[model samples]
Target: MSDEEWERFLRETVKDTTGAPVEPSARAREVARRLREHPRQAEGWRTYSPARPRRRKVWYVTGLVALVALLVALFPQQIVGWFGGDDGGQDGAPLAAESEAPREAPDAEPDLRPTLAEPFRGSPAARWADGAAGITVPPAKATGWMNAAQVERALKQSRDFLVAAGLDSDVLRGERPTKAIALLNPHQKDVQDYLRTALSSKKPDPDTDPLLLFSRFRPEQTRLVGDVVKTRGRLTYREGKRGAVEVTADVTFVYPVTPAADSGRDAEVIRTIVRRKVVMSWDDPAKVITEPGTMSLVSYALDMTNGGCSGPTGYFVPPFGTADEQSTDDDRLIDPYDRSKPVDANDGTTSADDDCATATRS
Candidate 1:
């Protein structure tokens, strides 16, 4: 082709491939200037044989293909940008090179630590203000028959005291009920003796503590954990041969299970619901009764672990009760009445009573 026509063709090709104005290479511009300055040499190229021209055309096409392949390999992202793709690269820089550039600093992250609620500081029967794991106190009933506030107070006090004594771990592990036993009302001597015997025994003995035998039947590697999530219930006053007030509560506790040694799995948390009953009596006949009057715990009972009360693991022994009547194998009463036992003057007047007695009375 003529020199002028060749130059125009090269310009158009460059513009089409790069989507930009053609800026001819120095060599190309020099060649064009030489051709323009030398008319005789340009004429000779135009007058070449037809077969020779075809051969030259073939070489030109091959060279053009190689140039295009090289440009595609080196400037792929630039080519993509030319086609409106987001390489975010400038001046034909490779995508990888652009990615290596320093980035702008990111904004600081917000704080995300969990905040713990303050623990209960008021009376025990008052609402438990601080409950973890989404636990909440149920609404109090308006009926004044039973002292709901007193019951709540008792439950909170018992739960907190038990937890502090490590009841969840120590009692289940057959360790001595050191801290927890102190909270038991003195009226529950039989129950106390039974628990002490069970904890002290090296092996399950049927004679000392019959209930010890059932410890073997408990689920292996399973133990009680967690705290009281919520409490709800009502109290009823009974006026009969033996006058007393009773409080029944539905208590929820959580337990976390460790993964089995052989199983490659995550640990799980399980919830257990226990029905607790507390009975209070004012032995003094002359004292006038009030909503939250002076009353002593006489009997306490917690439902058995399994479905029915038939299990060897008798229901949770109340903070007060005679072991003979409430814990025997044959006679298992949820709320038994045995007034024969001397009432524990939980009042501070008696040093023989448990220290918790003073706290409970207050």
Candidate 2:
């Protein structure tokens, strides 16, 4: 056959889809050359281009290493954490708000020691209202025979007398309680004559002493620590079976005193706790011919804590800081600040019972 006829026959017999010249691999040529080698193997043309030379694996390894380096540069902290290095923080480890040293817990106990400036600091009286404001009177209602207005007037008069007798600065400074005395009925000559003798007398009896009627401190000796006085109590009133209105006041007074106001702050200040319960009687004007708006003193109960046992009845001398703190040998534990206890009448009031006892607190 001619060369052109042979090429046309090859093209027609074995088609080349790429439109390029057809070629054979060495394996295919060898297979065709050696018919006896293997007759069962399959054969087919895969591509039209010539095979490329293989590249080394070193380039692939280098590319992978570069990718890892780029990631570490961008996220340094995350990279360090993966490697478990530098505690996963900048410079060193992470810091807390207070990283210097562990601090100790603070003390829980309160400082109770009294000072001239803070006399009521540790005592229960610290929370009490100051002066006359502390004396709280209940709402005046019509009690039995007395009208509401009369009841209110009687309550006010009772509170005024209490303020004069116990809370008045002048009375506390060894001055007579004229305001308190004027509130009492002049018909109470026994109570009046007794008060007159008690105030002037040098060695008065404890039960009927001037101190029983009022509170007084020697101006020559100790002085008040601060301008304010702490007080707390309640006033109550009721009409009795005899048709007379009875008004009573129960109050607690806290007086902080030092040798003098000029004394140093560190100097020990003494606290005098006095609880007084005074009874005032109002006779009905229609039934009895008595003074108008005047109430007579029926009876009273006074209790003082921390006063000197042997001191004279009229003046108060509180135990000194330099002396033994546990001066009272009596085991009778009494909380002077506790107003819940019943009012003590004749114990500390009578001359024979001039004794001291252990106090639970200042």
Candidate 3:
């Protein structure tokens, strides 16, 4: 209520970083007077330091907001509320924190950076649906070899594989792709075995890199920002060369991840985009002894953006700030987000080890 109380409060509450008691200075007295004289002037408390670095400013604003809340709670009687008069809000709603708001200073830009709460804010994936919903199937039509219903079944099965391979939480966290492989016809043991070895190997070679078929992250190194994995792409079907209906899935999956749970609140969010072109055949029962409801693998291709090249070759390693994609004299940088055209399949290179391209964004 009086100068004596204010001084006593400062002596008890305030401290320097070194833990030394901080006696309120003349500037603190002036700032206190201004806060008391004009309550709305409390809005000016946001303007902490004009020349501080952007991140420091964020921390400063956050500190100021927390301090205000503490003061309001601890000294509701003594501290004339800077937000309102001696009487608080009618409903007694607690004060809101403008914690991370940029101070009102020159070059004080708002933190438009992506965060765990809004991982895909500035990305095209923001508009995409989460997981398999984005892989839209075309209206089923009778292919030359199969009926409309068979074609639709093939498309749905193809989508299931996509979901398991890329969107499954267990698969993404570097687990086995059992669900994805189950969709395959058991007769195609060679293909299934190839996939198994691709994952079973601790370190894969160029042709057997499991990332080409599955989206996986090293759990010890990084973790998903949230449970959401935004996806967008299409599914189509046509007559296959082997007298079967071939369903093709062309889809892009975007994942936002951070260094690990221990990484602080402001940890950088790395966006890794994986695009796959998977073809599955609805085999002709008359010609082949196929399972009643199974799709056989025809062929597939993979393209990725922002997955670093130098990490363990088995899984996709999304780097902290920028992509660590390796470039060779024969390889070129490509836009991972640009799905305007199909990947140049004729290049004959099989893996990132053979034809790694640096990404523009990560």
lDDT of 1 by residue, 107-150 (tens): 22122211112111111211221222122223343223335575
Candidate 2 stretches with Cα past 4 Å from truth are 1-111, 323-330, 346-355
Between candidates 1 and 3, name the one with more favorable TM-score.
3
Residue by residue across 1-362, what tens digits does model 2's lDDT show? 99999999999866765687668999988888787765655645763556574555778888889999998898776667456543311222222222122234112214467776577765656656778888878789888668889888888988899889988889999898899888888777777787778788888776557877688888877788878787877787788646888887788788898875446658878788887888888877676556887877777777677655664568777777564244356567767766657765542245422555666666
RMSD of candidate 1 to the truth, in angstroms, is: 26.3
Q: What is candidate 3's lDDT per residue for 1-362, written digit by digit as tens?
A: 89999999888775545686679999999999987898763336557645656898889999999998898798764455345332321122222221222233112112346677778755545545677777788888898677788777777878888998999999888999888878878888767676777878998877678887789988988899888887777887788866888887778888888887656877888788887887788888787667877878777787777677774478777767654747656556666666665854411127744557766553
lDDT of model 2 at position 224: 84
lDDT of each: 0.35, 0.71, 0.72
Candidate 1, residue 82: how far the Cα is off, in Å: 52
User: Which stretches in model 3 have alpha-carbon errors above 4 Å?
Assistant: 1-112, 321-325, 328-331, 346-349
